[model samples]
Target: MRRLDLPPVWLLLFALAVLVLSRLDPWSLRLEGAAVDLAAGLLIGGGALLVAVAVVQMRQARTAVLPRREAAHLVTNGVFGRSRNPIYLGFVMLLLGWVLRLGSAPALALVPLYAWVIERRFIRPEEEALARRFPQAFARYREATRRWL
Candidate 1:
């Protein structure tokens, strides 16, 4: 069976849940305003930019971008130097943007859950792979870098 459990899959599902919860709104808590729109726009834009930069960096290193895959190189420069898991961090930013767009309490709450899932499913495994593949370098990198930022 194919591994359907992935970050993008959960991102989409959580986004859809945000939409549904926005409408159902059992909590009746909604955020609305011009500021909210501006914040959402910024988060979405920043997240997209961050993901793009990280993907480009990984590709330049000739490393795998997907989770639970072997990487050819240990990329510890550019955005990677800033955050160890910038892609997942970007994904969370995107989910936060979606929550703000939906403007529901339940929607906002899902962002952390999405982060947790990505960390458990992707980040941890990816880190282990990196540690195995580039033991000394990864140990140094991990010590200097934060997992998420």
Candidate 2:
């Protein structure tokens, strides 16, 4: 794992960017009402649960949480069975919730960008390592579980 390649750090940067971009008056979508608030809350809460579950599984397996690091074993059950990168997926969900909460059309742009960056900078490399480390299992898992869901 690269010492400086932190997923959460990037999440914070993107979140701050969303907040800053949401302030631009010209591009405001200005979504309002209880529905928006409830949706945002659900997304945020679900994202946190995903992250928490993924982390707990990794820790229980005695594997490295950081990307591109050596893994003790392949995680293919629970939340991982749904997505190869649950933590990153959770991060994107959190970003989407922020976009909805901010109600800015322009802020929504960064949500996909965040996913793209994480996929390019972290997920791809981590997958490469996992493939090399656990070839058959990785292939099976990749086929069964999507990179993102």
CA lDDT scores, all candidates in order: 0.90, 0.90
Our tally of clashes for model 1 stands at 0
Model 2 over residues 1-149: C-alpha lDDT tens digits?
45666999899999999888888758457878899889899889999999999999999999999876799999999999999999999999999998889877778779989999999999998999999999999999999999998
| lDDT of model 1, residue 86 | 94
- In candidate 1, what are the lDDT values of residues 1-149, reduced to their tens digit? 24778788889998998898899997799889999989999999999999999999999999999887889999999999999999998999998988887788667878888888888878888899899999999999999999997
* Model 2: lDDT of residue 6: 95
Q: Which lDDT value does model 2 have at 58?
A: 97
TM-score of 2: 0.95
What clash count goes with each model? 0, 0
Candidate 2, position 54, lDDT: 100
Candidate 2: worst-modelled 10 consecutive residues by lDDT: 24-33
